[model samples]
Target chain A: MKSKITRIIILLSYSFVNLYLIVTKKILKYVHPKIIPIIVISIIIMSIASMILILNIKIENHNKSKKNMYIIFIIPIAMILFIPFKQSECLNTNFTVTQNISIDNKEFESAGKQSISNNDVMNSKEIDINEVIENNKLDEKIKELILENDVIVVTDNNFVKWMDELYENKIYENKEIQITGFAYKESNFSKSEFVIARYIMVCCAAHMAVGGLMCNYMADDIQQDSWYNISGTIKYETYDGETLPIIKVNKAVETETPSVEYVYPY
Target chain B: MYKNKAKNTTLHNLTLIIITLSFGYLLGHLIVYIGFDQVSRTVKIFSTKFTSIIIEALPFLLIGSFISSLLHVFVPIDTLVKIFPENKFTGTLFAVVAGVFVPLCDCAIIPIAMRLIKKEVPVHIAITFMLAAPIVNPISIMSTLFAFSGKTNIAIIRVLFGIIISISVGFLFSLLVKNKEIINDKNYCSHCTINLNNTVWDKINELFLHTSEEFFNIGKYVITGIFISTIFQMMFDSIGLNNISISNNHALLLMLLFAFCISACSNSDAFIARGLMNSFPFGSIIGFLVFGPMLDLKNILVLNKYFKRHVLIIFTITLVLLTYTIVSIAFF
Candidate 1:
């Protein structure tokens, strides 16, 4: 009982919403960069599909009860295209740095055995981060940069790997460190101290976890959602029975938030 | 008279669309601007996270629909049957292996698997494809590899357990539903049944037609699914699951249920599991990785569209129990 053109309009909307996201680059906020290639492929496919649909039209019959199905697409498509919402950086709930990891050698060895046993069927060795970053993720540029400058300056590119270097701060104990992250304060923390952190997006914003070094600063001007540049010396101390690095800030200054807030591993 | 009638309906539809869109737009602005201090933040998170899932899976759904449409138009049903072994055991086994190669996520696999069922392919074979396709694909395995970088055992165990659970569940269906009615109505369309007289161009036209049709058809279910799962995501956020502590077995059970509720795509579910792995035991994170793809809030609703009510009930129970028993025995 419906015109075939009605269905064509719905189908073309499919192509439009996808195309709108890709062209606007609004999709970057939701998905990881690696997903873009497949999205482009899909856009191309949808274009051809809608083009063909426009060319070939017919008066198709349908039950009147089926009309409500068309309404389901409206709200989501509109929300996607028009809504002024961003995934908040306040997603510190799913993330907790302290963990009970099984570091004992017994469980580690058995885990290795079981991996090999199951992977015999696969016969493929997936290149993990360790393999790609052979030298503990310290590439020549970073190493040279560290050697040249007394202070180790971390950019967005090296933020994740360099922060990871905090776990073993043997080499960089006395090295002056400069980094930038948003201010995160816990109610239990001392008034002069807070965690300077940025969200480390694993696959997308949905899976982002906060990663940053703790800063012991005596500043009262720190604001939420504002970026801060902290220059300090790497100070290692035992906290909660574990040796951890805390930045002893000599200077802390508020700065404008960067264009891209979330950092991805890829 | 006919032309005028058609014209009026078209105008009516356009007016209807404008009203709905304007209403939706105003509603969105209201949610963002007009709200309680905490209410706005929850809504903000819900919208962004909900879209991330839909946008992330959109490409796969598009490609899956295209490939499935190609099969519907170009490939004959006989070819689909002949490609698989006629024997039940071999057919089910082959389907599970074939599932690993197809590389569609749980959401994308539904249309293909249901189409196979409609084409009179064995229910067990199609069911196997639906259950196992997402868990062992190349992209998923690579993601798992990266997520559990130092501990590759979790990645391998996920794939291993996925295949085992898939085969067992497929066999379970074969035994339980053999010689029983799965689909009550068999009056689905097959205009191309007389494609013998159609040209290649005609077949290609049919291909695009099916593609467009399938996109919208599957989309309704997908959007509905996204809505339900987002609601659940917001609920969990409010309840605050992080502070609670339970026994080892209870944690595993909770994780399985969480996987079903969140309805994350299989490829990205590994990353979510990684975040939780720091808190939960290694086995429960693996349970989240394994149980999620086989069944979820979204796919279960979509599955209801093609399957009978009782069939879905048993299917869900079988998958959950099989996944729980296998994962606990293997990892715990």
Candidate 2:
């Protein structure tokens, strides 16, 4: 059986952890900013509640089984402090990105159809890519970069949308591009092929999904989890019967992993 | 006798602290020796998801516990009974309306509902409040509106479906289960006597005492639910359901399953649903938005802990059928 003090300490410890997360600004990595104020209020209420519990500790409620359950609360604290904080790229092994690029004419359909189709559901509008780009009113620098055609850079902000555009329009036929990401190799892929991937985190590391373009390079020694800066040109490839955007590398150099590992969804 | 009890409690507490410290040391050594590389990535994903779920829900859990404390200590149970109308239909309707006003998250709703049920509120009404409050609230509405900005119909459909389904389920539960107490033996303490004439300080102390006790008791369930949900998410992610090609109906099933496992907050689920707008059908996306806030991995555990096994099962099955039917019919 545990005493009231033990219960109080457990509650206080949780409050302490929240305070720690709030102070360290690590809470943002796990939750949206909208919940931060709530977290702060929780800390205040929890700490006050803990103090009150301490002041009025009793000896009557000593159920051994219930006391044992309090141990579970310690897991979160242990996870945050003891576990080595690393990128969630561990999900690369099984994580799958949507690779099918079905340019449809029904872009203005009232509702999204299923990714697969048996009949005319798959048909979509063939909108002009250049006109769409012009209408988007992208930043002048990004516009210049995309038109550079020789060494276009794909940052986190424009990676997914840009890729989607290039895939839809098939404009990156032979345009050179430079991108930086960690290497991920699928089980079926050869040693010469890897995915240069980044996690686009919408909510937290747990909710992060993989976002990257496939790469075809000639480095058998490229290790998994190693970050690289690869200058490559676009190459269309059919892997496992699905056509996808593959970067044919011109130059590859090892680079330090970015401090902010995960990119937010644009 | 009192002195002996106090001494024994202190000794037991000390022993607990020692044991906890020892476990911590062993765990620390294990993590260091194995390192993250040796440890399976699946485990890290599980831990990361579990941690995020708990951290994300912690604030709401605290708020719910606090609200439960205030209700138990300050508010009288009979007052709740008085406010609820006599007709079961109106009562359920009242619950749905009231649910919209209180913008509690799923994590916050259970504790408050437990308190309500303890106060002799109708089981159906409490269930209505529990299921509806999370989705029908203002914050969720705003987020849904923002997420489906151009397509205002989706947001409206989400809110309307949330209310209709919740109220109908409340009626169904009302039919199956009577207005009896649904809280389990562990938490129901209505028989305990209270001294209303106690001083303000004593009342404050009593309030905090009950608050802390309830928090500790329920917090365990929250953590357990999160752990299980995280493992479920890891498995789901590993399966890579998104990669598969399926018909719209099958896609809805997969999405419903996904929503149950993911257990994202109602306020943020809109964003996730929006993200899926490109790949999944609109009906399935609606299913994701509607079904998740109402029933998910964590809240299932909470509901299981409080309600009878039969009642919980009935609620789950009923909610799933109703949500899927309404969404599919409306969209398809």
Candidate 3:
């Protein structure tokens, strides 16, 4: 009977977490907004399953291994309670505000240099943004900004497409661009260098990877995980023979957390 | 008894255990070398990743459990045994086709297959269904189509490669495993599978009870798989694994490595694979798409929960080699 109660409690706890996440909209932090419908259906099924489990409380069936199942499930539930409710807060409060030595270790970067050079053959070839944009239906506004705008301001929706266009086409070289994101510095980077990273959440946080342009701002006081807006011109940096964009910033200001935490492209 | 009961003390089992243990330790050291801890960014990332996977996978997992439980209570064993294909080739073909129609994700399919096997379905048919359903499903195909921006070739090629690989793997297994039960279903819990309720209410009760059992059992493995794979992905990312260069054949190998480690769901993996466009060539991208749903880190852990470790290891090796060969040939 005691074991039966524990099982019921565990099942209800599962439903409660789902409800809590949905009620608070914290589910958006972990997964895309599109998945909310699936989540709704899951909670309904679990809730029904729990009620059925309660009515059959006298079944007396679970063995020692059966009880152990509930024990293992407690790990995920407990860990979820500690997660920040908002996606933006997740970066601002929990993640790296400063460069962790492992990520930017000089030896590691140099070791990877050989492979980076291999891509120089591919990256060296010039890509025409105008032609590519006309052929491709994606990235309407941001893709057009390259030839028209004097200073392109990067927003959450166009962040990824803008990055791709800027990387390939030389039109953006030495052009002023304004961007805002969580500040992250690699250890191999000097004090003046850091990446303003934004997570590209395709479906959920599970598929997220750090993406941003490297910025060269001569300042000692940059918070690692906090959001910052930087005004800079796109410049090229060569590593082992392959060249990629690096921002040379004229104005670096610690900004309020961005309204949008992640860029949803797909 | 299950597959392992016959081969308890074999050198093969010992070697597999040692390999698994070392792989785990290697993962641990990688995190520690980077100074990971409770307060570290990696830990937070781990929590987020684990939670997201579970949350995303929950609906499919429950629906799978419900289907499995429904079969357990309502569908008689004799009926189940009757519907199974008589011939090996036809059975494998039928199972792959069933996967395309039913179209459950991997999370949902395992429990359903286990239920079928419990009802005396052929091991190969069930395993084939498990492998093929997630990959060839309409949702997965449509997602692939959308992710690749309606490149019919990418979606078509992926489904073609997936069907070929799983069918071959299934046909091979049917030759080896025959109709022997891979899972030990006897002398266990009195609550589910073995019981056949008469009254409608009693059957419904059995359904819910069995659903609970299947969910909890599968959830444990899912959690463990998520924990290991997420930590592995996070640790590698921290060390800048993706930033490294890939040259020629190495791209295919590395993409396979990424697919194994990353373990994204089949439904959404195309988007992730699409992101790999510039870094690796089309052949390697194809390898990642085909190889992932069949034999990834998460699926391996789930497969280990049922089959013998040696069986999984062998099948994994076979799947890897076949995918590499077929994809290389196709792209060549």
Task: Return the top candidate by TM-score.
Answer: 1
TM-score of 3: 0.74
lDDT of 3 by residue, A92-167 (tens): 4323211122334332222211223123223322245533743464355445555336887888766766665555
Residue B174 C-alpha lDDT in model 3: 61
Kindly indicate the candidate among 2 and 3 with the higher lDDT. Answer: 3
Q: Identify the runs in model 3 with alpha carbons over 4 angstroms from their true place.
A: A62-66, A82-153, A165-178, A187-194, A214-223, A230-253, B1-43, B71-104, B117-125, B138-157, B187-200, B238-264, B267-285, B308-317, B328-332
Ranking by lDDT: 3, 2, 1
Question: Which residue pairs in candidate 1 collide?
Answer: none
Worst 10 residues of 1 chain A by lDDT: A97-106
Error of 3 at A220 (Å): 7.4
How far in Å is the alpha carbon of A227 misplaced in model 1? 1.1
Better of 1 and 3 by lDDT: 3
Error of 2 at B68 (Å): 1.6
Clashing pairs in 2: A104-A124, A104-A125, A105-A124, A105-A125, A106-A124, A106-A125
Candidate 1 chain B worst ten-residue window by lDDT: B183-192
Cα deviation of B29, candidate 3, in Å: 7.7
- Candidate number that wins on DockQ, 2 or 3: 3
Task: Tell me, by lDDT, which candidate is best.
Answer: 3
lDDT of each: 0.67, 0.67, 0.68
